[model samples]
Target chain A: MSSSSQINKRRTKPAEVRIDELMSAAQTLFLEKGVEATTISEIIARAGVAKGTFYHYFESKQHIIEALKKQYIEFFIGVLDNAVRQCAADDWVSQFKVWIATNVQTYLETYPVHDIVFGVHHHERKNSEKNMMLEQLLQILVGGEQAGIWSLGQARLTALLIYCGVHGVADEAIANQLENTADFSEQIALQYLKMLGHGELNK
Target chain B: MSSSSQINKRRTKPAEVRIDELMSAAQTLFLEKGVEATTISEIIARAGVAKGTFYHYFESKQHIIEALKKQYIEFFIGVLDNAVRQCAADDWVSQFKVWIATNVQTYLETYPVHDIVFGVHHHERKNSEKNMMLEQLLQILVGGEQAGIWSLGQARLTALLIYCGVHGVADEAIANQLENTADFSEQIALQYLKMLGHGELNK
Candidate 1:
């Protein structure tokens, strides 16, 4: 093939790779400046993509922000899921501890990006992202209950309390710039386990 | 006295009353038409005060917003404090329970105003308002610990968990428009009490 044809072929990259490049570029600019300051032209320029390609994937800055939020939630949930899965299938308590630890650790490490994507919707009460995480916790709570490790008076309410409580405590940890999170996470897990009626573990 | 003098005398209201009138007018407008849409001129019009009076107390809309936030926090803290005070002095568990219940009840009743004042600053990491509320909770936790009502592995951390947890769950309650908050609050208090090592009460 001629050199011109080869150059054209390189420009026609896979759609997923193009979309990832655009999102990564937008995220970098959003961090450097802010969502309001960063524009589509800057994102396209940073990603080395054509203007048409950027428009093809995202209609506007707000559209891209929603896409980023969805992507961030998926990654956050995946990290928590993976951490819980490492424990023995029936080891519900261990599964929970790992979930809490991973959540705090991941959130602390990734909160800057998280703040970028989620800052606007932080006060949204009925958020789907929140429900998605709550569902994950509910599964664990129900599992532990099923195995006779613990019992719940109201599983969904209990899940909301735990989910929101852990998240709130993690926000405090971030504020305090807490060190020694392993011990911190352990203490949190212990307290929550006690709340779940697994006080026998305290012995 | 002349007609002009009579009108002047009417304008010379107490500073506290004038300020309260201004805040109330602004709050009414904020709820009716969001903060961004409400103007200082409209506020003065609603308060039946001159533009000079509005500017004398507040430099700009943003200044008034900050003032409103401080006022809101003070009122919120006062409400929680009053509810807790109604319990027996040494009844630490009842105090804590009342604190949680009142927090849910008051927040549900006044959250529209709360949202108007606090919406912008919701994500502030090290907010003084949050610290003030947290301090109130720490006092109860410390009191309970001293009385041997319960124990704490990490007093401040435990306080953060409970305070943030209760606040988060209350936000959920607001979202759900929960009607039976008395029972909801009791369940929350029981779970948190268990976390505080008062599991004996569960029997």
Candidate 2:
């Protein structure tokens, strides 16, 4: 490879690689000892990186975690957005199935955002920015509801259930409760949404 | 009345008074300094009780906090249960109004629980023995679906939506965004639920 090619690979790879590595460390520590018990020094140590290198990427400990959370919510919203687009091309049942596939794919991809994202507690008043997105989420959901393509009865409630099912996957994934014998997380989430949207068992 | 009679009156007050006082102290410090920074000493100091006195009523920090959480969740579930019970005597609209009333009452009364229960970084994941009663909630909702007493669409989704309205109240109340000036919180919740259940914009 040329010298420029070598530099390009090294530069692009480290940032993404370091982020994943740091996130894995945080996830491990956060699980073993809740978020309160884990610290920045421990995270850097586990990632085998200098403290300054960690700081180069993150503003604060909670900052990185919050970033992780924001990324997760954003990704799931993308999944939903994609589902909405897919549903536009088909009917409700088929739409729900595509949604399930998208949800599972997004979750199983291991983007290293799960630790502080979907399962994040919403009670802290400091998480104002994140909570703002939820309100906007309401706006988007309401728009979808009015569109007749979505078939929303209670937009807010439907959002919560759908979020809960997604959150359930994260919670289970974190605690490692997902049984290895079956890969039903995606199907279960689909069933949950189908139950909410129509409540009809398989025809 | 004599001093003795006044002392007797004080003595006869409910046990929850002391608990409420302790929880108030813990909640304030927990919000200010977080669960890790807030200590038993701080809680007792704020409550103006002896350290031993604190120990007399509670086992440890986690125990007391769990007690507070349990009481809060129970109080919430109790309100929902009572409302659902009362629903048997009324039309579906009135029943939904009653249910929403319970949601508003619980959210208003336990503002701290709303603070602690949501948005916090740390959540203790113990097996929830208390959630068993939720089956009762499911039964009541499913029964309504079977009776065609609901909107003739997805009853499961309807239940989820109504619950979301309840959950949304916490976030709304916490953010001080609930401007139920023309409508009371209960009334707003009821209207939201009615809209979800029947897709109605009317009384």
Best candidate, lDDT: 1
Model 1 lDDT per residue over B125-179, tens place: 7888878988999899999989989888888778888887788888888898888
Give the best candidate by TM-score. Answer: 1
Determine which window of 10 residues in candidate 1 chain B has minimal summed lDDT: B194-203
Q: Rate residue A160 of model 1 by lDDT.
A: 81
lDDT of 1 at B72: 91
The per-candidate TM-score of the B chain, in the order shown, comes to 0.91, 0.59
Write the residue-wise lDDT of candidate 2 on B62-160 in tens digits.
877777677667777777777767765535555555555666666666666656643343433323522333354446555555555554344443444
Once superposed on the true structure, which residue ranges of model 1 sit more than 4 Å away at CA? A1-11, A201-203, B1-11, B201-203
Task: Give interface RMSD, every candidate, in order.
Answer: 1.3, 6.5
